[model samples]
Target: MIFFYTARAKFNNENGADILAWTNYIEWSKLTQLTELVSIDTSINEVLVETDRTSEEDWKEIVIDGYHETGFYRTLDHVLKKKILKDLIS
Candidate 1:
């Protein structure tokens, strides 16, 4: 089975067909925050992603375990990179 998730920060276009970014540092439900971002950059952001479903669960574990080391997304700077910048307040 293949699963897809839209992350908060990414390099995507106006349609948001392609999205890529740092996903090793966030929660699952947090993906919703990227919607507005997808709309703003609906013109010039394209990202390529490579995935391995076999490790998806392990990936989640790693992210959770490493949270304390990197901390959480507390600043707008953390989530504003590509079109997603529009979704942020800062």
Candidate 2:
């Protein structure tokens, strides 16, 4: 199961306001949705930061199908949660 975090903006422009108010909202979604968005807009790759989840064969297949090409390949070293917390506190 692949999961991803998406951060988006909520805007309010009620009562004929001259300016817009916006708030940042974050949510979690499955890989399927992400692939759908990618299929619609390939430009998303500019801001996409994929993690180590692509290393698995099943995950890789889904990504390749979504991307419609095999050229976009990347790998990053996986990190442990304990090490991440230790670094954060120190």
lDDT of 1 by residue, 1-90 (tens): 532232333432334344343232123437645543432232423322212237543244222234341212223332233225434534
Q: Estimate each model's TM-score.
A: 0.16, 0.19
Question: 1-90 in candidate 2: lDDT tens per residue?
Answer: 643232211222332322321111112332322212323233332223323455564254323546464333322322233235445777
- Residue 77 displacement in candidate 1 (angstroms): 16
The TM-score of candidate 1 is 0.16
* All-Cα superposition RMSD per candidate: 15.2, 12.2
Error of 1 at 89 (Å): 38
User: Pairs clashing in candidate 2?
Assistant: none
Residue pairs that clash (backbone atoms under 3 angstroms), model 1: 12-45, 13-45, 14-41, 14-42, 14-43
Model 1 poorest 10 in a row by lDDT: 69-78
Off by over 4 Å in 1: 1-44, 57-90
Best by lDDT: 1
